[model samples]
Target: MTAIQLESASAQSKHEATLPELGLVCITVSQEVRFRTITRTRYLQFDQKERKKALKSIYEDNLQRLNSALTFCEKHSIKLYRMTSNLFPLCDIEDRIGENLLESMSADLAKIGERAAKLGIRMVLHPDQFVVLSSEKPQVVENSINILQTHARIMDMLGLPRSSWALMNIHGGKSGRGKELIEVISQLPENIKSRLTLENDENAYSTSELLEVCQNAGIPLVFDAHHHICHEKLDSYDDESVTEMFYAARETWDNPDYQLVHISNGKDAFKDRKHSDLITDMPSCYREAPWIEVEAKTKEEAIAHLRDWWEGET
Candidate 1:
């Protein structure tokens, strides 16, 4: 039903394919039901051997799906994808699964990365919300570092250069902690630091706050346009602020054209934070960043619909 996956397209479809309109970045296929969606690791019967087996299988499935996703993106002309952090989820027992996993899946990772590289498709990782660096507690920060280290190792295994396309994006955790978060980011290994990007949160860090963090850390900023609409107050952030936000974010990238943005629409008027199944319009402040991750419930299908809609306007 999505516009991107149409079976029968008239002359309009062919003309639309050549237009440079919105950069609709997709995250995996939308048909999660029809697709073999694998989210969590299954410990069949909690048996030790079974647990290890399950972990290996999940890792393999994730990579396969990632390769499949890359192919899907290339076919649909979607260039950017946000990879799932659940790829390994072995952080609970990294001692057991970390190095062993690298050795086991190195080839597959390399091959998959090669596929992505060849197709000129971009990939990124958004570690879940649990990864909080603003916590004053040492263990929480330590755990967060360890998790990102694991993510860095996977990025290395994939042979993705330390760049924005192969980056680890996170939010400014615990409001008023942007400075502290930058200090933590400073201490990270060069490999991890180079690939880190900070995003503005809905309630905590606004466009103005995270801008400083990214500047200090020498990393790019990912502007979530929907969050601005949903969480930012009219009196606080003005049209000029929106313009500055986009400029600051795009400045962080090596090539300004590769700047990434997150786009989504609210499901309802009252619940603006909730992502709608389809995004019908781009924010007025947005001016076609080089890359934009469409944060819609419909996933790839939504990108297709956007493509179809954009073609009509062109």
Candidate 2:
């Protein structure tokens, strides 16, 4: 299987020499070559009798691809990875086939987790945008719970710790519904709640608002510097203000060493929500973060650029 290739020779050499001491930089989903994910539309194409069979086949392929991804990360000395939420497609539907994925694929999941642990890699998941637990509608909230439960089950099968270090990150939905979100979170099982993390978004919750909710819910907050700058309430991107927000978010985590921050440059301007192909300027505040997930369009290539830039400065 094809894997991410570091484009910069200097960056490659630098990582080989000094990556162990530096905090990890993560790449989302796939790099260079995208991993395969099946949509509900494609699943509907299969006949009723064949649907279960098709789902099993797709799931197995996804697990195999995940193993390949872990191998790629180990080879490149990339220690953090955000897994695709579509690893087990259609499993969230009430009447969906292959609902017993944990039982059927237990061995595969265990092996993947073992490989990651042995290689000293950290894995995380970010459920898609539709998981809105704070929605006022009961059905929407119920669906969101179902989706989150599915993610928690997968993490359990992988034998990951029940903590934010292997987080299932999501945005604060429906902006002023912190009370509703906290209530729903209280109802969830410990397995799901322990691994949950709230993040600030460009259009919705600002750093201050999310910090309050995270504090109430007893879960860690993921500080996104780009999102903080985009939100009108906290428009300044100065080092002092950003660093203060970073510290506030850091305090929410159980361990400061497990604190995860997101870094990205806008496609056009500083306030733009669209991520650029490479991160040109990272905040000085983020140097204190333990794990930084690069949100650039170029995926692992962007990480290579950041590594080169970081090495140049230090």
Alpha-carbon local distance difference test for all models: 0.70, 0.77
State candidate 1's TM-score.
0.84
- Looking at model 2, residue 44 earns an lDDT score of 79
The model with the greatest TM-score is: 2
Per-residue lDDT, model 2, residue 230, is 80
Candidate number of the best lDDT = 2
Candidate 1 structure quality by residue, lDDT tens digits, 155-263: 8888877766577888888888878898998899877887888888789888878888888878889888667655665322235666677777888776565467888
Q: Candidate 2: where is the Cα deviation over 4 Å?
A: 1-33, 233-236
> Clashes in candidate 1: how many?
1
lDDT of 1 at 98: 34
Q: Deviation in angstroms for 85 in model 1?
A: 0.6
